[model samples]
Target chain A: MISRHGTPEHLPVRPFVALVALAVSVATFLWAGTAFAQASAAWPRVSPITIVINQSPWFGGFSKVVEAYEKETGNKVTLDVNPFAGSGEKQRNSVRSKEGQFDILVMNSAWLAEFYHGGFLTPLNTIDPAFKLDPQVMSYDDTGYWDAARKSNNAKTGVVYGVPINGNIQVLYYRADLYEKAGLKVPQTWEELAANAKALNSPPNVYGMVQRGARSASDISYDWMPYLHSHNGAIFKDEKAGDFTVTINSPEARQALDVYVNLAKTVGPPNPGSYGQAQVIQALLTGKAAHATPVIAAWPQLDDATKSAVVGKVNVAVLPHGPGGRTTPTLGHFIGGIPNNIPKDRQVAALAFLRWFQSYDAQVKYAQTGQPPIRSDVYAAAFMKTPEYRWSPAVLASLPNAKMMYTVPEGPQIASVLELRLNQAVLGEKTTADALNTAAAEIHDLMQKAGYKTARLPPLK
Target chain B: MRGTADRASAKAADRWRFYTLAPALAVYLLLALLPIVNLATMSVHDIHWQQGAARWTLVGMKHYAELPRDVLVRAGLANTALFALIAVTAEMLIGFALALFVSRIAVGRVLYRTIFLLPILLPGIVIGAIWKLMYNPDFGVINQLLHLLGLPGFDWLGSGSLAFLSVIIVDVWHWTPFVFLLLLAGLETLPQDIHEAAMLDGASAWQELRDVTIPMMVPILVMTLAFRLIVSFKVFDEVYLLTGGGPGTATEVLSFTIYRRFFTEDRMGYGSAISVIALFLLTLVIVLFMGMARRRMHAH
Candidate 1:
C-alpha cells in the first residue's frame, strides 16, 4: 500500500522534470534569437540578386558596372548574360514561368508590355513609397528614358514595370567610300535608298544592303519594324488599346513588304533569307555589303581590330524615310527590373545597385567602353566626345524619334510567323500580299490558342 | 549423405545466383530504373521557376495536344528519324567494309585498327566544333579547298538540306569506328576452321564472306545496329553544339526540341510530354530489337 502511494510522488517528479526541460528549451531559444539578431545587425545586409542580360557590348559594359556595384554596396549579384540567339523568348518564358532565378532582367522594350501584363514583373508602384519619393534615389522622368522606352513602360496594369538600361535603336550604316564612288548622296527616301543600293551592288561579291532574316524574335522584328512604321502601318489599332489586332495586311504594310522583298531579291545578298545578325554585321564590316540597317550597338564592332575591315570608312545615320516622310526606327532597349522572389533585404541591396549603376557617372563610364548610355547628359559628357565615339551624339539624338516594336503577350509566336513569311517572301516563294495574309492568319490562330481574344481592327480611312 | 548433398547443391545455387544477378540488378535499379521512374513521374507535372516553388499543377494531355500544332516539334521529330536512319545505315556499311578490309590485311592490321578507332576516342563536342569550323561559309578550309579547285563554294550549314547532311557526315566520321571495333572483334573471334573448310571446298572469297562469314557475324551486327540506333536517336550534343537547331529549325532533333521546351520555353510539363513520348518510342524500339536478338540467338 505504501509503494502504491509513492507512485503519485513519482508522477509529480516526472512532471517537474518535463517543466524544467521546457523552461531550458525556452531560455536557450531566446538567447540564440538575441545572438542572431545582434550578429545580423552587425553584418552589412548582403542580398543575392541575379541579373539576366541579353548578350551585347552594352551587357559587357554592364558587367563592369555590376562588379563596381557589388564592391560598393556589399551585395552579391549573379550576372547571367545570355547571348542574343534564343535569349529573347527564353527570358520571356522564364519570367512567365515565374522562375525566380532573376532579381533583375535587362529585356528589350518589345517584351516589357507582355511581361508587365502577365504579372511576371513587380510594379515599381508597389515598391515602398519612401523609395518612390526619393528624388535622388528614384526618378521616373519621361525625358530621361527615350520616348519609345517610356511608352513601353506603360504597363497594361497601369504601372511602371521597367526602367531603360541603355538605348538600342536601329541605324543605317553605309560605306562612305562606296557611296562616294557611286556619286550618291545619303538617301533621304526609301526610293532613293533602293536606287543607291542597286547602284552600289556588285553581285556574288559586294551586296548592296543586308538585315537580319533569320527566324527568331529579334532577327525578324528588328529588320521589319522600320519598314512597317515607315509605311504608317501600326501593329495594333492604338498604343493605349489592349486589343491584339494585327494590321499586317494593310495596304501600306503590304507595300512595305513588297519593297523589302524587292530589295532582298535584287540588291541584297544571294542568300539573304538565311542571314542572321552575325552574317549581316559581317557583310557590312567585311566590306561585302555597301549598306546595312544594324542595331547601333553593333557599330562599335566596326572598329574591332580582329573583325572589321572597314574601320574608319563606315558611317552611321538615321534610317531613310518611306511614304510617310518619317523613319521610325525600332527601339530594342534593355530595361532593368527587380525580381520579387528575393527577401526584403536583398531587394533593397539590388535596388541600390541598380540606382548606382544607372547614375550619370556610371552611364558615362559605360559610354567610354563603347556602350551608349541611357541618360541624355551622358551623351554630352567629355568621355563621349572622344574619337572612338565621334558618331555617338548623332546616334543618341535619334533615340527620341525611335518607335517601340509591337509588344504582344505572344510576341515570339507572332514574330515566328512573320519570320517564316519574310523568309518565303525573300525566297520568292510567295508574293507580299500572300505572305502577309498567311502570316496574319497564323498570328490570329496563335493568339487565339494562347487564350487572347481575336482582335478586330477598325478599317483604314 | 543425401542431406549433405542437398545442402551443398543449395549453397552452390545461392553463390551462382549472387555472382550473376546481384551486380546487374543493383546497377539497373540504381542507374536506369530509378531515373526512368523519376522521369515518368515528372512527365505529368508542370514545372517552372517561380517565387520559391519550381513546379506547378498537373497538366495531363495539354502538352501532348500542343505537340501537333508545334511546327518545330514536327520538324524536329522528322529530322531525328531521318538522321537516325541515314547515320545508322551509313555507319554500318562503312564500318563493315573497314572491318572486312582490316581483317584481310596481312601487314599493319593492329596499326589500321588503332587509327580507325581514333575518331571514336575523340569527344563528340570537339568533333562537332571542328566540323562546324570546317563548314563555315567564309574562310573555312572546305570552301578554301573548293575555291582552289575552281569550284563554287557551297553554304554547308546555311542551307537546310545541306546542313542536315553535314551533321550526318560528321556523325558518320565520329561513330563509324564504334561499329568497326565491334565488327572487328566478332571477325577476329570467329573459328578459323570454318573459313579454311569453305576455302578448301572451292568457295570464292565473296561467297565465303556472304555465306559463312556474314551468317556467323549476324548476331554481332544486329547487336551493334540496335545499340547504334538508340544512340543515334538520342543525338543531342553534336547537333546542339554545332547548329543549335538552326539555320532555322533545319537540323533540330526531338531531344533538342524537348530541351528547348523545357529550358528555353520553360514549359517543363510540355517538355516532359515530349520526353514521355520519346521514352515510349525508344522502349518500343529496344524491345523489338531485343526480341529480334533473342530469336537470332535461338536460331544460332
Candidate 2:
C-alpha cells in the first residue's frame, strides 16, 4: 500500500484508532465550547416577540431601533407593519384572537382611550413589580397610566399600562429662507400667523399655508384641534373634569372656525379641503407650501434630501396661540403596551423590550436615527446637536403645552362628527356656525346615548 | 298498488335528496345564514368590548329606531341611490355602445375586447389608487393634460360639487367592461335573421337597435343593469381612497357609513343595524329584479 511513497500506507491499527479518537475528541471539544459560549452569551431567557405597528413617517427610525435591540439582546423581533388607516383593526383583531398574534401593540392617541377603557393591556407594574417608567419620559398627559375605577387616564390615581414611544405633537413649520427674505417676524398669535400667510401667498408657486382639511381617517379633525384649543374652545365643557356638556358651537369655536376657514380659503392651496397629512407634508417637501402645523414626527422627512426639495430651508416653531389663549398643541403620541391576550412569557419579553426602549441609552440610539425619542433627557443628547435634529428643541418646547384632543372613550366617535362638519365648513358646504351647531347637536345626542350627563350648551357671548 | 308504490318511492327519494344535501346545506347555513342571524341579533343589542370579549346589552331595537335620524344614514342612502342611478346608467349606455361597436367589426375584435376588458381585470383597490393619483390636482395626469392644453385645471375629487361625479366616473371606467362583455355575449347569441330582416325592410341602424336589438336583449340588459346597480350600491373603495367621502359628505354612501360605524367608530350594534338594513334593501332589489325577469321571460 505504501510502495509509491516508500512509507507506511496506513498507520498501525491501534495508533490509527487512537488518532481518529483524538480528532473526534478535539472536534467535540471545540463544538461544545462554541455551543456553551452561545448559550451563555445569548439572552438569559429570550422569547421572540412580534410588534404590531402602523406605517408612519417614523417607521424607518422605529425599524432601525428594533434592529439595534435585536443585535444587543439576541432576541428575535418581528415588526408587523400595516397601513395607518388599517392598524386599529389589525390591533383589535390581534387582541381579540384566542391567542394574541402580537406581543406589542402600538396605538395612536386617538384610539388609545378605547384600548385603555377596554382593559386590553396588562399593566406594566403587574408584569414586574420593580419596573418603573423613566421620570424624564414625556407622558403626553399621563396616557401611560389608567385609573380602572375612574375609567380615565390619570397620573395621580392610575397604574402604568403603557409607555410613550412617540412624542408627536403639531408644530409650526415655515420656510426660514422665505421668512428671512421677507423680513417677517415669527408668528406668536393666530392673527400674526394670518398676516404672515397673507404676505407670502403666491399661487401655483408657493402658497402662504396649507391645512389638512380632508375627511380621511381622523385627519381634518386632528388638524383643527390646535385652532380649537388655542382659541379657548373645547369639544366638551371639560373632558377630564367629568363634564360632558357639548360646547363645540361656542363663540370661541366660531372664532376659531373663522380663522381656520379664512386661512384655508384665502391663502392655502386650491381646494384646501382636499389636503390631508400626506398632501400637506408633500406640499412642504416640494416647497409649494410656505407654512403648516403638521405633526412633529414629519420633521425627519422634511429634511430628507431624497424626498424633500426644501432641505435645510425649513425651520420649526411652537404653534401660534389664539387671542385670550395660550399655546396648546394637540398631542398625537404612539404608545406601546402588552396585550393581555398574549402568553405570560411573551408579555414578559415584550415588557423587557419596552423597559429598555425607555432607557436613556436606548433613547440616544433612537435619537440618532433622526426621530424624536420619548425621553426628554435625550433631546439634550450629543447626537441631537447635529443639523439633522434641528427641530428637536422646538418639539421639546412645544410638548409641555400639548393637550390631548380628548380623554374619553367616545373621543374617536366625537371626532368623526367634527371631521365631517369641519370639512363641510372648509368646503363651503355649510356655514361655519351651522357646521359647528350641527356637530354640537350630534355630539350632545351621542353623549346622551352613551349614558353621560351631557347638555347642548348655549354659544358663548 | 302502483300509485301507492310510486308515492312511497317518491318519499324515499325525497329523504335521499335531503340526506345528500345535508352537508352542503349545513355548510351554507353555518357560513352565511348564521352570520346574518348573528347580525340580526347584534342589531337589537348594545355591544361593548371589554378586554377581548364582547358584552351585549339588550337595547330593544333602539339602534333601528335611531337609523331614521342618523345624519350619516340619511346622507348615505341618498348618495348611494344617486350613485347607483347615474353610474349604472352611464355604464349601460357606454357598455352597450362598445359591445355593439366590437360586434360589428370584422377584424381585431379580440384586441378590442382585450383592451376594453383590461380595466375590469384590475383589482378594485388598484383601480382606486390609480384613479386617486390621476385625480390629484397638482401633478395628476388628468390635470397636467388640462394644464398643457392651456385650460384651467380643476380638483376633480376635491371639489364638493365634483367629488361624487368623479367617483362615478371611476366606477364607470372600472366596470363598463363588465357590462360590455355580458352584452357582447348576449349579442352573439342573438338570432341574426331578425336583424337581417330589419335591415332588408329599410330600417335604419337606430331603428334596428331600438326595435330589434334592444327589445330582444331586454333580459340580458335587465340582468346586467341589476347586477351593476347592486354592486354600485356597495361602492366603498373608490370613495375611501379618493376623497374619503369628502371634501364634505359629498360621496358618502351606505357601505362607507357601515365601515365608519363598524371599524372607525367601533359602534358594533349600530353598524350591524345599518348592515341589516342594507342587506334587506339589497334583498328587496334582488326580488324585484327576479320578478321582472320572470315576467319578461313569460312574455317572450
Error at A123, model 2, angstroms: 0.8
The reply for model 2, stretches above 4 Å from the true place, is: A1-43, B1-19, B197-203
lDDT of 1 by residue, B203-262 (tens): 999999998999899989999999999999999988776766665567879998887666
lDDT (0 to 1) per candidate = 0.73, 0.89
lDDT of 1 by residue, A1-461 (tens): 23554655434576788999999999999998776576455334456877777777567677887776565445678877777645566566456553455677676665554455444665554554433312322222231222233334332224554566777788888888887877889887778889999998897678887867665445755698888888887665554445667677788887787778778878987667667777798888888988888888887788877879988878877888788648778877777776555556656666665666667766767777787776777777776777778668567657767876655545655665676677667756667777777777777776665566566433323
Cα lDDT for residue A19, candidate 1: 93
Residue pairs with clashing backbones, model 2: none
